[model samples]
Target chain A: MTIHHQSATQLTRIICAGDISAYEVTTASLEQIQAENPNLNAAITICAEKAQAAAKRLDESIGRGEIPGPLAGVPIVVKDNLCTEGVETTAGSHILRGHIPPFTATAVARLVNAGAIIVAKSNLDEFAMGSSTEHSAFGATKNPWDHTRVPGGSSGGSAAAVAAGWAPISLGSDTGGSIRQPASLCGVYGLKPTWGRVSRFGLIAFASSLDQVGPFARTAQDLAAALQVMAGHDPHDATSTAYATDALNTALEKDIRGQRIGICPEWMSGNGLSTGVADTVSHAIEVFEKMGAKIVEVTLPKTQEALAAYYVLAPAEASSNLARFDGVRFGVRNEANTLPEMYKSTRGTQFGDEVIRRILLGTFVLSDGYREAYYRQAQRVRGQITHEFESAFADCDLIASPTSPVIAPLIGAQTDPLAMYRMDEFTIGANLAGLPALSIPCGYSDSMPVGLQLIAPKFREERLLSIAAAYERHAGQPGVAS
Target chain B: MPDITSDDVHRLAELARLTVDSARVETLAAELSDITEYVQVLRSVTCTVTPSPHAMSSVRKDEVNPSLDREELLNAAPHSDADGFIVPRVVG
Candidate 1:
């Protein structure tokens, strides 16, 4: 297998034109991923055989004179947390090191059915627990732009794989900032749909209230295309909305004419965003303004309180969701003298430091004496924030902000846990409010990429994608972007 | 004073279903006190007694859905045979 670099759409065009076979593209993508992944550490697991077989099937379909799908012969990567039948879905944890799903996740299976080849499973913070890929039990995925720095996580591997040309597009989950943060750092387009926009059935739960599966790609068009095929209401996941998936490519055709944009007070305050990030976001807003969009100053008053509420809420939900990992069921186990010992041994031995820390904090807040005072109070604040967002949208069509408060922090410079947790301040509120948001690379921080975020009301994904896809042509992130 | 004791650590660990080595219990107890103190920030937040982060209610259905087959559910065990998940037997 000789490795080469080509976009997913480009590969499909090639196969459509009979320039190459799907098998050739899959083999080349795997070979290229293998060659670069050792340095990138983006791929948590590679499934070359399954990918090749799938490609063979696509080729067979084409040979039979049947019309191929839009993503036919295109190879893609997926985050490790989404289940793939017969393939290990470790979620970057030691406990599920060899755990394979009997059935594929609804979203992933739908992607396969749409004819996109699943090439690899990307690394993440174990259980999507941290902003940095450093928390991944398997090891950190490095920024392809500069290998010494992180690829921003827990979808770091997915973003890095796309940015590094290991894959043209990838699937990721955002609980808080997992998908967008990493996409920002890796210089790609990542979108987390409104809380219920995408199906979450096959995904291993993290913070259940905040978790949303999304797509990552080099171009906003690719992200939109991948999302169209991957999103929809699954009767299995009650939270999924009933909207028909938006044809992401249509917005690029409609043009972003008269699109109204807002640069919120939370985004403009340089205190939170780095100088480079702030400057680039401002420049992007300027570009949008020149392109006939109105920019306004909007306030998200509850944003400051989001970090605290998320800290309490995410951990609380995670603690409950993760309780299912007890050794008596599956995963790693240690002999316990009692039934309680089974729970003790599984989480104690299997969970990484961050996961344990979150669980501890979660349990503390949800405990009897503190339940009303802590968890209940945090929920109240979250409600207020959601209301604030609904009101903010009344003033602006779409809210724009810098994705993270700052550029990617140095790999191990984090000595304070609270400071590390604050990294998701700008991005988490969208998740908290169950709103759809996209992070597209607007500029760079030194040599690394930075993202500008656009958020829209729930079910207005087409508008959000149209606004984002318009900016796709004039500028593309350099060095690291796929 | 909310200075948690080793007894408190043992209890909270049990509530959390976590295993803490004897050597770490004393340290954890000390850390828990400081954390509990830090967590007092939540008390300062005033609200209308209405719980904030509303639970996603639509997740549950009133209709009782069929559970996964007992055989398949048990088969998900790491170490399973025809009848059950084989764990270290605990006998009093």
Candidate 2:
């Protein structure tokens, strides 16, 4: 197989064994990125020189018989929201167009420390506010399956890059389906680890509580391998968990027989769920049953209300988290006479429309008169949703549903703001409840891939991976879209 | 649900410190109203449980570590000097 076709696990083994040099793999990845990025626009920044230098160093270390890290010599892509020291991290917003962070995000630093070379920074929706990647300041990423359609967002570029064979693994942050929905549209695997599974030290914050950094890969094992390196505690981030991540790689190889897979009928036949996606996910359940896995019908009545709650809670947090971007500090500055004028002009002009809309909505929700009615009420609902998921997990090991309600829509197709928010109907519950969730390609609909979402209780990423790996063994890896 | 009027949008823009163009205010008002109406579903559901923030079980000792280079951080600012970041005249 060509270097681009090999998974990260395969590439590492070949490089370690001295059969193929890391330089060869890195060059092939860079070449593919250069040739295909123009048509797809999946990557915003390409680090050819730095990637080549890093790959050459790995080859030298291997030549000397020294062991590099577990992910030695694998080329990876990171979503632009995660900071890479001295590299321009824009978070897909013009406000940070030329801002180079002074420090690296803990998750990205961990991957790099493990010998993974970053080939590029993928695109995302501005501040991860929108479900469709069309909200990005640097143009929309076209779906690899069909260019006319979007690849999903705000992590659309990361998902598209993996789907288009630019990289085997990429990192993306999920606020509300930013990772999983795009993974579904692009026909790849994407996971949003439990809220504190990965550190958020240097990730440009959209919603502090809802955002979790995870990986996108073409193979389930690649997802596990990437997570094994990225997960764990970071002292810099207080919210990072001290839980053990050593079992992730081993868990994927275990048998999934007799595992209880929960199916929620309300979500399965929920409003606006496309018939194509519904049928594909239902078939996935049958396949699990055929493989000796028990399928249980579970009820999560409050989950349908999660979408409304998330919209309120996320935007409310965004207003506060994003308040740091005044004209005086880092990022773009608009010259003005007064300091207050500078803050107003800089934010008003630099932030995109969606960002402004979100900030306004956030401000309104948290406003004095409406706080009890909207913001506090949303928090109460968020608590209830978490309780609902906890109760449902007692009957099942994992919950299964459609990752996205529909396939990738045409660019500019979902201009209505409310319509765009509904794209995350099935996926927001996981984020609200702070659970580990993943999307794996189950089948194709309308010649495009559909994702089967598996959500597990907090800190249970291993179980999700084990079942995903088993399903991949049966369903086969999705064909690369070129 | 009460309709989001132009005055409401103006007030929100003022509070958020964002300048909205005259051309866009009407559209913003309509969109915000529609979203507000949609989210009114939350009122139908009762949630009496008190929301507890996620537990932070791994907070480290409060010790000062080496910070980033002062020059490097100052250099990223739009206006900075040997002393600190410079902003528009506020006290004058």
Candidate 3:
């Protein structure tokens, strides 16, 4: 296989065995990105010189007889939201156009420490507020499978980067369905780890509680390898869990035989679920059944309500989290005579329409006379949804559903804000419950990819990975878009 | 849920420190109203459970760790100097 087409694990093995230099792999990845990025728009900032330097350093270490890290010599893409020291991390927003972070995100740093070379900073929705990359100020990322279609967002560019063979693995942040939905649309494996599984130290905050950094890869093994490095505790982020993550890659070797996978009927037949996606998910379940896995019909009545609660809760947190971007600190500043005028002018003119809409919604929900009815009620509903997931897990090891309700839509297909919000109907439940969820290609619909979403209880990423690996083995790896 | 009027949008913009353009106020109002109305489905949900926040874990002991270089941070600011970040004067 060509260097860019190989998975992270394979590339690492090849580089470590002295068959090829890390510099060679990094060069191939940079070449592919430069050639395809113009058409795909998957990458916002390509770091060719930096990546080449990092890869050369790794090759020199190997030449000096130093053992390579697990992800040695692998090329990776990171969503622009995750800060990279000295790199202008725009987070797909015009406000942050020239802002260079002083520190790298913990997850990105971990990947680099493990010898993964970052090829580029991929695009995302503005502050991860929208479900499509169309919200990006840098311009929308086209799906690799079909250029006219969107590669979902706010991590669309990361997902498309992997699917288009620009990189073996990429990092993306999931707040609602940002990671999984885009992973689905791009026909790659994307995981939204249990909320605190990965640190959020330098990730540009959209919703502090809901945002999580995870990986997108063409293979489950690549996802496992990426997550193994990205997971664990960090003192910088108090919310990061101290749980053990050593079992992730090892668990992928185990089969899914005798595992009980839960199927939520409400989600299976949920509103707006396209018939094509439904068939693809059903077929995926049947494949699991054939692989000696038991399929249980589980009821999660509150799962439907998670979408409603997530919109309120995520935006509410966004309004507060985004308050830090005033003209004083960093990023673009629209100078005005007064402090208040500057704050208004900088935020009002810089933030995109979706961001403005979300800020307004968040402000409205938290406003006087509306807090108790909207924000507080949404929190209560969030609690109920969490409780529902906890109860559902008692009956099954993992819950399976369609990752996205529909295939990738045309770039300008969805105009209504509400219609765009509904794209996350199935994937929002996992984020609401703070559980580990993965989306892997199950089949094709309308000649585009459909993702089968498997959600496991908190800190059970191993189960999600192992089951996804097993399914990938049986279903065969998804084809890379030519 | 009542429709979010342009007046409501203006009020929200003021509170959020966002300037709503006169040309976009009507469109913004309609969009916000649609989202709010759609999310009103949460109102029908009978949520008796107390809202539990995400549990905090592994909070490190309070210690003075080496902080980022002030010069680097200052350099990233739009207006900064040897002292600290500079902002528009708020008080007379």
lDDT of 1 by residue, A1-482 (tens): 12335666777788977889999889988988888887778888899999999999999999898999978887889999999887888899888877877778888887888889999999999999988899888888888877778888889999888888777778999999899998888888899988888889989999888999999887666777778887777878887766766455577666665776766775577545677888888898888887677887777744557777888888899889988888767566777777777779777878887777677778877888878877887788777778778888888889898887677777887745566776787898898889999998888778778888898888778877777766765664233343
Q: What is candidate 2's lDDT per residue for A1-482, written digit by digit as tens?
A: 56867899999999999999889999999999999889899988999999999999999998998988988999999999999998889989988988988999999999999999999999889988887788889988899999999999889999999999888999999999999999999999999999999999899999999999999999989999999888888988999988988778688787889999999888898688999999999998899898889999888845448888988888899999989988666889999999889999999999999999999999989998889888988898888888888889999999999999998898989989989999898889999889999999888899998998999999999989998888888988877895
Worst 10-residue lDDT window, candidate 1 chain A: A473-482
Winning candidate number (lDDT): 3
Better of 1 and 2 by lDDT: 2
lDDT of 3: 0.91
Best by DockQ: 3
Local lDDT at A291 for model 3: 92
Pairs in clash, predicted candidate 3: none
Say which prediction, candidate 1 or candidate 2, comes out ahead on TM-score: 2
Q: How many clashes show up per model?
A: 3, 0, 0
Ranking by lDDT: 3, 2, 1
Q: For candidate 3, what is the DockQ?
A: 0.80
Error (Å) of candidate 1 at residue A192 is: 0.4
| Native-to-model Cα distance after best TM-score fit, residue A379 in candidate 1, in Å | 0.6
Model 1, B47-88: lDDT tens digits are 543434433426565788875577755666777788788876
